[model samples]
Target: MRPSSALVLAFAASTLAQDQIPLVDKVKGWFAQATAAVTSAVPAAASSPVASGRAKVAETIQHPLTLENWKETLTVDPSASTPTTQEWLVYITGGNATCFGFCGNATKAWNASLPFLAAKPNAPKFAVIDCDAEPLLCNSWSVGPPSLYYFQIPKPLADQSAPAATVRYQPLNRTSTTVDTFKKLVLDNDFEKVEPYEGYFHPFNGELQQYGLALPLAYVMWGFSKMPSWLPMILISFMSRTFM
Candidate 1:
């Protein structure tokens, strides 16, 4: 039988609503499943042993000493550690807390020969400061972990009031990290060659400069003097005649 127009329109609207409702339910169900899957995975990941092991490792790693703990000695601030007026051979070392092999080697090498070097009549003062323990001091020295430096703090003159300047010793070409090599470097190079010194200058430089100035003149005079003594008088007469 042919349906009435109004009834047919109503029936079409109801069918459309029913089709849209199922689509909406399907989308909601898919989202719920995805959320459940993610929520279930989170706790499983948190309970992982690998994550726990990494935490344990991070805890086990030892950090370096703080600046406050920095002392003036290897074990103590020795009573006989008198301040000196000479230059200093400062060993800025680090990585001991972590048991770094390089630091171990360098410290061992320095320890072996330091006593002998300290006993010399005019030898420089020696001090060992951990790099990590005193970062600011080490950074001021412009050195890195496990390195040696020569430092000098010249006393202010009797007439001056300002602080004395810090002098850093430059190794001209020395690179070996051994005790004997260090001693040789200390022996071979004069500390005065470096700048920022007080009442200390390279004495030979002036003489060398004077010699440099006189060398050419001496050479010319020598060549002239080698000629006969009569040559100059003859040349003078010839010049006088030509100019007359």
Candidate 2:
């Protein structure tokens, strides 16, 4: 074969080997990548938005629910003759802290939505329960603060002794944590029925997209450069026989 043809064949063989021949190298690369991924993931998992948001919410709320009025505020009497179809639109706030001593995002959303939400044919009662002040009450239900829970009473009745059964409004990873979303949650009366909002790009894909094609092509070129000259000839010959 001509020098140019031989070089071309050799390059082609090297490219094939770079992808398949170095088994040990491939394994080591995989293991290293997996280890790095796990190591890098630890901190991110620990400090997720939900985790940090809850902490921040806790810090903001200075005045929480007190034991004195807790029972009276959350009570629902279903056994009475004129029993009302009661539902509690409770905001399990981190604290009494609003963004500017008024109301936070969730609170503001509720404030704007209140007119519409209350106008519903059979609207539920609305109240905010400070998790910071009522940790025991909040913890009993395994709730993370700065969340919303809907309570259907009357039928459930007020069992001051035990915690109320509530439906958590856990929208798609906090996407549906808005007042409009909560209003929908209340109107639908089922959190599960609500579809997760996909308005934003997926976080995993966003990170990958930021990398682009340069990094992958660079790795492929690096692998090709590291290939042994003879390795390509062997691969090419093997391919020729396998095909013929």
Candidate 3:
């Protein structure tokens, strides 16, 4: 007896299903392969000298200075067995949002100096402060962004009462020249050519100064805001007639 068409179709369908992998199984296989690849790559990446070097540079060489850690940058660690005489080189740059057009060249020069600076013996403690992140702190220094400051922190880091020596690096052109000049500044330890930073480092002083300037402007703005919208046009017309 011949098999019915339904039985033949059912047999064909069963064979096709057995020959092809299920979508769920294929997805599982792909995931397993990706996981294995990532796992194998981790060891290779971890062992890479370049990766380790970069990490070390970031941690030790480029110390980020913020309002919170600003004091630590100026002070030495008491836990150390020996007193460190390393001074600080602070690169203050604008934030991405507030960056002026002039920051590009300076930023490039600053970054290029990092590797060279890190390699130098007895290099100054390099730190970067972002103006946008710490506006009050930056303002306290009374210096603009894209500027470099060298601070000769006092010894016995515990002495908070001692004043720190601060100097500003003069503006230079081109990244290569700027890098060379920066290296020389650090190496020669020359402050004669560079101008001294005369700004007060107290945060409260900056805040008070800012408020002093802002209050007058704020009062004027409030007065204008309360005025009638048509008052400005009338005032302009009156002024024009008087001038004519």
Candidate 4:
């Protein structure tokens, strides 16, 4: 073959090879590009206005319900001549570090309903409890995390020594529908189907249960107090030596 013709044939072979790439390889290349684009988009989407707005709502609207503030947050003063009519809506959930399953979606729905509930007149007070933070308070109430409880405290709040009437929101799924129902329940103050809180008030059965729980620890401490101070030090030294 002529040298010039040989060069032209080689060039044509290269061009044909390029065009003859396998279909599966081309598809894989396209898929990789698409996946990269989606991955890059996710962080931006996560930090979008919707997410920021939810964060803002959580900060501004929901009050952290702790053991210290639970009574002040939930109960009302009956002695006041001009008693204010107020009730409570509590969202109980596990800690962020330990949360799983429906906790994320349930929390999102709870946060989303706050703005609507807060806008209404005579809106029920909103509080949230992190079960991981207030395990004792949650346990006394026999409440599991990621649950909603609506409390309707009756008058003579002090005399009504029983656990307040409450209704729990139990939804089959976590969605906007749950949010709407939560808001509606608060605004309407509709507790036609209320149930006595199975959990005891701290002043009542709860206090006794708390003491019962602490009895073992108290006994241990008492035993320690009776022991010679040198005993603990010797035990500690022995344990350290054993471990070593």
Candidate 5:
């Protein structure tokens, strides 16, 4: 008797599954906390700034951002962007709930900084949500930095360079003086150009987007909600087969 092809196929599939792990589940779990982590960061960032009026716009744009106002001030044209009311917020933060008090550093900085950038006259196509005390997330999108997730309306952000082009990964942090790294992501296309938002969640809305997100978040949320069902299933199936 000869071994059946089905048996060999089954054996190969079994091996493949054993060789890998279910990634969709992993992806879901991997960043499950990401949304919560970002949400938690919001209050901390907003607490001080909303209390202070200088979150956006320097007391004087005539000068560059000074050390005194670095944490709570920025210098950009207020007329740069049009004003619109939004509820949902996406945040590009360092890490999780604990990241804010511990691993987090730029959380507060972003909160204070974003408002000003968003309020700018013709302020690009996106609004700056906040800078964080933890600067890691918005600096690079590799390790240690928070994961950048896209949501409803992808905000228009430039790259971390001068004369920024529209990007979907990393959005520009006007407060970051890195220079040459100005990011520009499109509001419609998702991650069509660059790497994950600077480093953290939606740098524009500030998170993976949630039920409450409006403007950028709302837009980002729409995108996520619209994710092709077949794709996720296919991805899940392939991952299941590969990683089992």
Candidate 6:
């Protein structure tokens, strides 16, 4: 039989072990990002329909987590999860080249790139975040000059603290950049830190939507709030333990 992927990776790891690879260091970039996302989104969570927004918010955001400090701490059960590694790349324009924050144009650009991604059957899913005015600039969304931020939306819950990749990049053209070009630039960086490799199965997707979380079907749980937190926790714990 062919060598197991783990065995092959183990050999690679052993061979490269002496290289002093700063895996998580390269990926920990999202630490600040995690803090920002958590802090900024807290408001939205607070105003959520739930009372203990802190708990629900923490838990849900916890579910769709990011990888900002993966090496320092990795607690998610990796064996049970399918791997969908992720990334987030941001390019800025306008305002003296100083990046204020998320950009809408980049978001649009990413939207344009998705159809093309249909070809990468095994690649992590993708999404774009407009950084023109969120973490770096204003606290709210606004229209601004084009900038690009690419992400690998890993299989939803790929990691406990779901940090995506910001593919390593340098300036490439001013007006337009293609997704393929972006992918080509970042995937093979020797210096790029990237050791936080964990995996998980994504439960929420189109199929689930059609069956459960779908509109009318989801409404069936409209009164779900009435359910005891203990019950849900018990279920989630059981479900999580069952798979992991």
The digit string of per-residue lDDT tens for model 3 on 187-219 reads 665545776645433222334344664334333
Q: Highest TM-score: give the candidate number.
A: 4
Compared with the true structure, what per-residue lDDT tens digits does model 1 show for residues 1-244?
3344444443444344334424554465456556766777676545357545533442333123333332222121233233424466665576522112235555555555565565667766666567545544443333455655554444434453324434544422212356665565466554455564232221112232235543343334334434554555565556557655
- Rank the candidate models, highest TM-score first: 4, 3, 2, 1, 6, 5
Best by lDDT: 4
Give the count of colliding residue pairs in each prediction.
0, 2, 0, 0, 69, 27
Instruction: Write down the TM-score for model 1.
Output: 0.38
Could you tell me every candidate's TM-score relative to the true structure? 0.38, 0.40, 0.51, 0.54, 0.24, 0.27
Residue 225 CA error for candidate 4 (Å)? 29
Name the weakest run of 10 consecutive residues (lDDT summed) in model 2: 197-206
lDDT by residue (1-244, candidate 2, tens digit) is: 7665665675685576445425664465456556766777566445466545654553343223443454465556545443344566666654321111122456445545555666788666666666555544443343444566555444332443333333434412222356567666777666656453222121112232245543344344445544665666676767667655
Candidate 1 — which residues are off by over 4 angstroms?
A: 1-85, 96-100, 162-166, 169-176, 190-244
Error of 5 at 229 (Å): 32
The digit string of per-residue lDDT tens for model 4 on 1-244 reads 8664554454444344334435664465556556766777566444678867976987877789876687676765546433244567788886432232336667777777788888887767778888767765665455556677776665454454444344444332332446766655666654445454444333223444556653343333334434553555565556557655
Stretch of 10 with least lDDT, candidate 6: 134-143
* Cα lDDT, all candidates: 0.45, 0.49, 0.57, 0.58, 0.34, 0.35
Whole-model lDDT for model 4 versus the true structure?
0.58
Candidate 2: misplaced stretches above 4 Å?
1-65, 77-84, 95-103, 155-176, 192-244
Expressed as tens digits, the lDDT of each residue in 61-88 for candidate 6 is 2222122232222232345365645443
